[model samples]
Target: MKEITMPQTVRGVVAMAKGAPVTLENIVIPDPGPGEAVVAVQACGVCHTDLHYREGGINDEYPFLLGHEAAGVVESVGEGVTDVAPGDYVILNWRAVCGSCRACERGRPWYCFATHNATQKMTLEDGTELSPALGIGAFADKTLVAAGQCTKVDPAASPAAAGLLGCGVMAGLGAAINTGNVGRGDSVAVIGCGGVGAAAVAGARLAGAAKIIAIDLDPRKLEWATDLGATHTIDASTTDVVEAVQALTGGFGADVVIDAVGRPETWKQAFYARDLAGTVVLVGVPTPDMTLELPLIDVFGRGGSLKSSWYGDCLPSRDFPMLIDLYLQGRLDLDAFVTETIGIDGVEAAFARMHDGDVLRSVVTL
Candidate 1:
């Protein structure tokens, strides 16, 4: 293929300082080297992690390219790459499991031995090196990442919807299917009706959960929860979540209670919202400063698993395509999660909306 004149700078949202606004500007993107692939991003969702990066919760890496939930088409491939090719519609995965670690050695390659990431550095127009969030940053028209990070999915699905499986949706689904092991006729309660919480509701429903109680303070999100398959909704602002869940589930409790909010209060609710010998799945990512205080006897008395889900135990190669297939079959309502779409320049404003719980997901389309 004849190489055209590559633009020396590509437009991106850059966080140059902590607790500052992200500014869109021309950034210098180097040619793909080694196992890297330059992806032409179609859509990237504004996640809490992006806001955390701006607030320095992730790291002190200034000039960070903030975004991870994304779907894109591969524009170019680098040396020794074969997993994906140019023109493939792919969802980016942060944990591109390395296949030789202790976890992988046990035949669980989903827990990879070593994960792949971008090998080349993307920089600013002024020659400052920019750290791409999670090594697969997609908050730009184009971003570079390891070929392993790309999981090709059904091209017909909307990018804004498909991209969500790259993060929050995957986390929530994984918590239910992967961690909680929610089964048919099982009763499940989710303590939070945000994107992840609602996703858990959907996943549990898909997994054959009979009674799914959606708990949240906001009425808008409760409506969204109902739309996404929550059989019942609990306004935590009006009633106690644990008591409400117990009342609904035969006066015992749900079989599984997932703490999508991840705070001490919500976690406590999850602990008491489940029946004895039931599961408690924590999918919410908590801040570093937050601490939990629970009785040790309760831990032993529960007689069930207390687990945390990471990225929904997502194996991109396995889960992404399967979820996309489900979406195409009309079984999974991935489209319902996309509340609105915006351009790259709208990411900062999208962050404000996310903070206010105004939308399920604000996707940035290039």
Candidate 2:
């Protein structure tokens, strides 16, 4: 085999300043240093987080390369990288567990103490430093990341579909499976029918939820939710969501209520939509300024746990392969989530479509 030399400069979208539109420009992607890997990005999804980062919702890190949810083939590896090799297809994970954190010491490497990222800076064509989004910027044809951040998966699956499992899909699925512990015969209600919420509906169905109620303002999203295994749909724009969910669940409320929208109003709805001893899982990301005001008595009154799920409390090493296998077997409907396939240059337009709520996901195919 010939030694492959990656392009010295690759086209990537960067947010040069906060609250500004992302500009596609030539960026310098360096070779993998120690414990690093360069991935030949095959596909990356445009997520709300990238938009948030662009608007300075994430941090003051300007000149940021924006993208995280991605799937690709490992192009090269640095010294001491033994976990993956060139030619291996992979799904990028933000939570690259360190396995030596306090959480890991307690046998929970899922909450790694010291997750790693690329030590090298991928710069602009003019040699200005560029901060890769989430440390695995896949907006470019190629990106650099820590070796552990890339989890190998089945190459037979489409990169457009498999890349989604890297973020929102995994977050939603894990919220139901790992955080909510949705089980056979459980009555589940998902507030918000976006990609993550719809995946929660699917996850609940996969876990054998007897009645999966989908709530959303958009009828189209609800329809998509139904296709993803929602047993019932509630049009929040026309009806009271909590009451609608209660009526569907024999008036006792659902056994598991997942607040996937993250707003205080929706969180309250999720709080009130579940039966006693039922779990309430908050998988949605709320803005920092948003505050929740609930009765302390209600907190004690609720017998079950009220939990917040981070990235669906997922373990990338374990979930990625299993989900890929499920996708391959046609047991999980990953394809339904892909409403459109686009090129890297289509990211900005995809973001606009997302705001319009017209598509489930517009994946960027590199």
Candidate 3:
């Protein structure tokens, strides 16, 4: 355990009400409790999940401290903590799996049911409790989290690029490499070309897939996808996605079709755009209001795995540092994902630009 010298309060972005603008407020961060650590955030990426929290799309939890994709230095650790210490550079992960959970017992910690967060709540100046989004809440100068959430990485890596591995980018990459099991000479098709989708395309390329097809309605997003490593691009606004994918794959469809959009229509497209016995990886998060209506016969006929990727089925401790190394080695272009870096004050504006389809990520560098 390390000695704690945490501040009584720090400036943080907070969502006070549903569908309302988030504001910077003084948040009281308590000293780390047992199994917890305090992190001095260096960089945090603005993700769709944060915007979802603001719009009440995730839940009714108000006064939310929103920001998850992050990289930082360890400021302190609490009692019984030894895996990390002060001054260690790390990437923050949302899933800090509990070792005693069923999934962990079975050696699948990525699916662990008991992910943890700091026992102490971060509060506003008025003592109002703020729910840290995804239990990370890194849109601040510092944040408290479970010690396991912090995955140590090389200090030489750019914080802006490394932080992205904490969420969207990791999910996208894992959707293809981990869930899709993309391999050399395989034909992979990714639906949606947002941050997650673009990373999936990159992941497919990294995994040595022979042909990568990127599908998106936005031409700019498609271009970004190509930059990431899509061998082919489909303009969904004017073309039939399934047909285009099939056409590119010689009428057999792709070996792995990833649905990064999570919409019912996109999921259906992914479902039908894979070859017989091909994998369908659903990495995009779908809202509760959305429903799927697939024929039972098709489910049997597909004869392949239909898997939903939770955080891209990534094990943070294993993936973060490895991906950072790949980025440093020039094999993975993590810098391409960082569209811009802004101060904490620019978060609200970043949220607006996110919808414009021009930016891949707006990182907040503290």
Specify the highest-TM-score model's number: 3
lDDT of 3 at 65: 97
Off by over 4 Å in 2: 1-7
Model 3 / residue 314 / CA error / Å: 0.4
Per model, how many backbone clashes are there? 7, 0, 0
**CA lDDT, every prediction?**
0.89, 0.90, 0.94
lDDT digits (tens) for residues 24-43 of candidate 2: 99998887878888889988
Model 2 weakest lDDT span, ten residues long:
1-10
lDDT tens string, model 1, 139-233? 98889888889999989989999999999999998899988999999999999989999899999999999999999999999999999999999
TM-score of every prediction relative to native = 0.97, 0.97, 0.98
Task: Identify the runs in model 1 with alpha carbons over 4 angstroms from their true place.
Answer: 1-7
**Consecutive 10-residue window with the lowest summed lDDT within model 1:** 1-10
**Position 203, candidate 2: lDDT:** 94
* Candidate 1 residue pairs in backbone clash: 98-112, 98-113, 98-114, 98-115, 99-113, 100-113, 101-113
